[model samples]
Target: MRRVTAIVPALLAALMLVVVPAVNARADLLGGKMTLRDENKMGHDFDQILRAQQNMVGDTYITDYVAEVVARVVTGKRPMPFHVKSAVIANPLINAFAIPGGYIYIFTGLIQSVDTESQLAGVIAHELAHVSQRHVVSRIEKQKKVTLLSTAGMLAGLLLGIAAGGGNAAQAGQALVIGSQGAATAAMLHYSQDDEREADHVGLNSLVAAGYNPEGMPQTFEIMLKNKWYDNSSSMPSYLSTHPGTAERITYLNDRIARMPKEFLERKDDNTRLKRVQALIRSRMSPANTALAYWDDMKQSDYTPMDWVGRGITLERLKRLDEAQTAFEKALSLAKDDPLVVREAGIFYFKSGQADRALGLLQKASIMNKDDAMALFYLARLQAEAKQYGEAARNMRKVNELVPEDWEVHHHLGMILGESGDVFGGNLHLAYAAVYSMRLDKAREYLKRANELAQTQEQKDQVRELEDAIQARAQIGK
Candidate 1:
């Protein structure tokens, strides 16, 4: 994910090593892993595990942006997993990481730090490199035999800046005692100067291959270096330390850029697009900040359909409904052919309770882009709210099929099914919905099989209340 640039705990030192692993090592690391279907199952399972955490740390816009940017950059070359999921952890720190099975998180601070599209793209490419390579799963598997510092301990250290907090030495000691070189090994997880060089080389190659200017990487590093001047000052954020600057890293980047072809070296920045996107991001920032970014974009007339979309979105978020509507309409006018804009307009209509209009726009957007889950999801939601159970169920099912990691769809599906009088299916989905929503009572109802399936007592108890609720709801109907 493109990290939000801001102050953050320097946990990356302990986190850099546990990135994506090799594809071939995936199943083996998890032990008796199944096929792609099994991978999907694991993804679903893990998504549920993290769903609560996801909801608590809202502002998913960053996640959507990162995923879109990365996928856009690596379009044809790398096949993104069907259920690539992302969320922001609501931290003011500038850090981002990917968990096994495609769970990615970026902090808000990370978003605030970067100034350019390519710079953000560089971060995405780096994270994607981890995912495509399957680094995290490999580390998890490696840890099984060694029993490294407990996940809880590592998580605390990761979230709390163990190195800067003087916890690294202690964590390293723990790792050594357990014969677990995990956290200790993690601080040094950065590519051996060689691995670092390779990632830089591959990362640059990936950026250019993705059609972005490779210079974004060096430019990003340079921008980061600028943060050093602010170091230890009142305004300086903790992210600088977590990212850990090295003169060698910057020097290497400078040398690398110099070696590029002269034509490539002279490539122009996408100032227009960058400014527009930045404007939209700014609008989402505090009012004062939004005004600042808006003025910055005003100097550049190269706004695209996406810029309008971003502004529209920010307006909606700010609850300036009228202004937001105008922005969306303007966006639609500028890029009538752009399905994304149409979809946002449709959502605006849906949120405003103009169901018929929303459905029309959403259906049109869906026709324009067959695989757009947001359009389908909202359309399905409006249908369900209107009690068009069958159509709603069908669309919801499509949403679930396209993006099963989104548990909310299942919750909605379960409710629709229940309302439609399909008690059995409804009950099943209700269980899934509860599991995703972390609703204990509803979860238990669906947990008939889960009781046996659950390895932990907490999971067993989770299903107990759900079973009673399901039974009571069934009895009420009878």
Candidate 2:
């Protein structure tokens, strides 16, 4: 487990040194005239490390919602060299960033902190601008004296620091990379002041062109600034430290927004989906007590069906089954047609041992939104419990397609297929689940079994392909 964890970062570093074209006898600091392929390869490697080590939120609903926002941001924009992908990290820190290529990561805390969808879009646009502008590559090119080990160490340390709460851990990370060329390495990771300003300018333009309120840019900065004071910690937020001068940024963004046409500033994007996404994050990602308290506070004044849904979820997580059931019933009564509300009610019923009620509600939810992977997952599990192997396998297969990287989905699918006498399919999915879960040895074992069970040349070839991938990944560190 730890070996895979330790290997990928070093592998990424090695790739960067060997793949980057040398500029001169004195190494190029920034990116050494790296090609699009180099940037993408670096980003891809970093992304793997993140998926393996970070607490990524795998809920399909949440991911789909964020992807929709990304789509809107990139619409009509200049085509990126690499395909853009967004991921939500399950951390309660108000931060967002773009890795080299077009990979954007938003913390759950940032989503939870924003007042509206446009504000979130503003932050995303800023990160997207970083990738579009190739700031990471530029910064890497500037650090002429930094070694591959130091570069990798800095990237690993910074990411780990951000994941570990962006305080002491981040500072420790800086210290760890503070070798002979500490200043240069630090400069490489944190963009120059000019880069931040440029990103803000470019990002604001993209946000407005995408039809979002320009004010969202400043509003997001204000939120980050206010959070700085709210935290009152010995260390500032990683967002603040990494992207410095929040106050100045907020002021200028507001000035720029003011200078824009009144009509452009007033332009609105529908925030209904944004609110729903926030509710999901709060109910699912936040602590049970925290979510409970938040929903209780909201309902104390005026409550919507969504608020009731949130309360029910928090209550269920707290094991207050009776109260949770009542809350879900109320939510369902208030919004019988709402798929999310229905899904929550179904989950509540399932946990309370009312499989029939769970199945009915979940089935209804699936009809309402065939893409609701969570509902389908639960429905499949209930069917499996009732020994409806064929129906369960079908539903699980759909879910596996919907969330291919989800370890739990693959694990369940593997179990269902194995029970249904599809040994080859079962082992293949089990191998995938093991690989995603960083259990490389288990993955190899499953792949070997799958190879033995292959019924056709195509199946054998597929197994061999997977085996090669596993071998390559295993050798990454070495």
The residue-by-residue lDDT of candidate 2 on 1-478, one tens digit each, is: 0111111121122222222211111344434576777677666666665575666776677888999898889873567666899988776667777877788887777888888888999989998988888877766665545354433444455455444544566556545545423465434545567888999998988888888888888888888777787654421245765676778888899888878888997777787877887887788767789788888776444778878888888888788988988888888988999998898789789878999899999999999999988889999989988989899999988988887777778889889889889899899989988887667999999998998899899898889887876775553322
User: In model 1, which regions exceed 4 Å deviation?
Assistant: 1-52, 55-93, 98-117, 125-145, 148-195, 205-212, 227-242, 266-308, 437-442, 449-478
Question: Quick one: best lDDT, which candidate?
Answer: 2
Compose the digit string of candidate 1's lDDT tens values, residues 62-168.
44556676666566336665455665544444556554455556554455567767777776666556555554443445453322234443333433443233356
Our tally of clashes for model 2 stands at 9
lDDT assessment of candidate 1: 0.57
